[model samples]
Target: MAEDHPRLAEAQREHWQSTYGTHPGMYGAEPSDPAVHAAGVFRTAGATQVLELGAGHGRDALYFARRGFTVRATDFSPAGLEQLRAAARRQGVAARITTTEHDVRTPLPLPDASVDAVFAHMLLCMALSTAEIRSAVAEVRRVLRPGGTFVYTVRHTGDAHYGAGVAHGDDIYEHGGFAVHFFPRHLVDLLAEGWRLDEVHAFEEGALPRRLWRVTQTSPGGLGGS
Candidate 1:
């Protein structure tokens, strides 16, 4: 199934680059609702360092930084990362945040048990195969400190766009040059296997009002330990 979309990842990367280039800070400056909620969760967990995947233009990353959490934000699009860096500088949170060009399909460039909390808004549902998504979660597990918290959101099978657009198999569909892998509920449960699954809240975002699930989980290790 993964093989069917050999070029999907690269194509999506290019499309994102172009999109970000054309629409700087496209998502605007306000922090997302999930980010606001994740910030509280991280604070309650005693987290200081935050790792955010798919942090385009640093809206949530800057919010995390301003909230006193050190942030490392990564995205596959260099253009997006550049915009994030610029925004961080303008917000005077550049010292509190770092940007990296990364693809979630690859191993995260961080040591094991490093960050105290991780956040990803709509990152896990990007044009990735099932195996790739599992591997990405495993990488997240590896990089989280003992008992670290992870808050992420993904478009689910119930989303209106789930089956729309150009089908690329693996539940991934490309619409307006953006590819998304709409997740099934079983896949979410599968990814939460070794972790303490906390919550799966259903919500909507954007004018399309994309339906999504906000998942919160904790590492197997006890909270604030190690």
Candidate 2:
């Protein structure tokens, strides 16, 4: 289990850093559809600021910034963050975007109820354990303002590689030198505890048609902080 092995965790980080450093455009240059839809939803909700987790290469972060939202883009991989920073500068949205080195396993570096929206694309499934996912959700909730929006996507357990790789822990699998923690349907409930479950949709993307769940939830404004 990676949770039981410090070296395993470090290796996982190195793998991602290397992946980003080598390929650079691992996910491509275009912003994802879910991100665009989420930005519209946030706009509908009167949001002006967004906190994006695992903002690799800043496609979605730059998208949000270009759409007039102040975005805090975070990723644990320094190479990825640097790439995002460079993209933001080149896109002329550097003033609207802040790139940060952050790991979702730890507490967030923002204040409570500070952001109007939280967007995370396939980040929850990136080698995170169930406990870590719960902690990350808690942090997201804490950093969101009242009635804030939360939009995220994760690989569904029904994906083609669900059981193809070596088992790490729980639903986590190591395949092709990458670790992915596929999410079962029940995992959605873990994030819906203190928020309103607004949308849960089946989404597939990329050439492999990677199966995913696009979840959108909203934090209650008052008398709702459990």
Candidate 1 collision pairs: none
Q: Which stretches of candidate 2 lie over 4 Å from their true place?
A: 2-5, 222-226
Best by lDDT: 1
Candidate 2 all-Cα RMSD: 2.2
Highest TM-score scorer: 1
Candidate 2, pairs of clashing residues: none
Q: Rate the local accuracy (lDDT) of all candidates.
A: 0.93, 0.89
Q: CA shift at 216, candidate 2, in angstroms?
A: 0.3
Alpha carbon lDDT at 152, candidate 1? 99
For candidate 1, what is the TM-score? 0.97
Specify the poorest-scoring 10-residue window by lDDT in model 2: 1-10
Per-model TM-score, in order, reads 0.97, 0.95
